[model samples]
Target: MSVEGKAKEAAGYVKEELYEHGKPPESQKKAQEGRDLRNEGRVEDGKPPKTTKPGTSH
Candidate 1:
């Protein structure tokens, strides 16, 4: 994944960990943004997007 994407993912992960009892909407949004960015980067690199089970981390 691209550095930016990885960074966003890490931020999201931190947020999730910090709020383990309940994930804020922003956290989920950040995570989705990270995944989308990573997928875009993969496409630009001429590779397929990585797949994961729904509701699971990449």
Candidate 2:
């Protein structure tokens, strides 16, 4: 393959890896939203939000 083709192939691999295993964990924004819903007793399932640790998967 040409240099450009090889570079594109490598980039494709990187994109696939990132898609399969997402980037590093961030804040619990989604969990917080769930908590807010729980606090308001508006949760769909009437369940509290699941807690998440920093740098850990939800």
Candidate 3:
């Protein structure tokens, strides 16, 4: 297999390991939570969640 193929397979294995034994990283979890809240039209402390345009740095 090519190097790229091996890297992809390794990444899949790591994902499966994490799914079986560990939580996803906190930052990713938080980001998904924020997205879910936004989709639900939730406001925290009277302020809507801040959003950023894709491909733009904060």
lDDT of 2: 0.39
lDDT of 2 by residue, 1-58 (tens): 2454444444543443344333434323433443343333322334343344422555
Put down candidate 1 lDDT per residue, 27-52, tens digits, no spaces. Answer: 66655665565566566556677677
Better of 1 and 2 by TM-score: 1
Model 1 ranges off by over 4 Å: 1-22, 54-58
What TM-score does candidate 1 reach?
0.53
Which 10-residue window in model 3 sums to the lowest lDDT?
Answer: 38-47
Clashing pairs in 3: none
Q: Model 3, 1-58: lDDT tens per residue?
A: 2454444444543443344333558645554444444423323224343365422554
Candidate 1, 20: how far from true, in Å? 10
lDDT scores of the candidates, listed in order: 0.57, 0.39, 0.43
C-alpha RMSD (angstroms) for model 1: 4.8
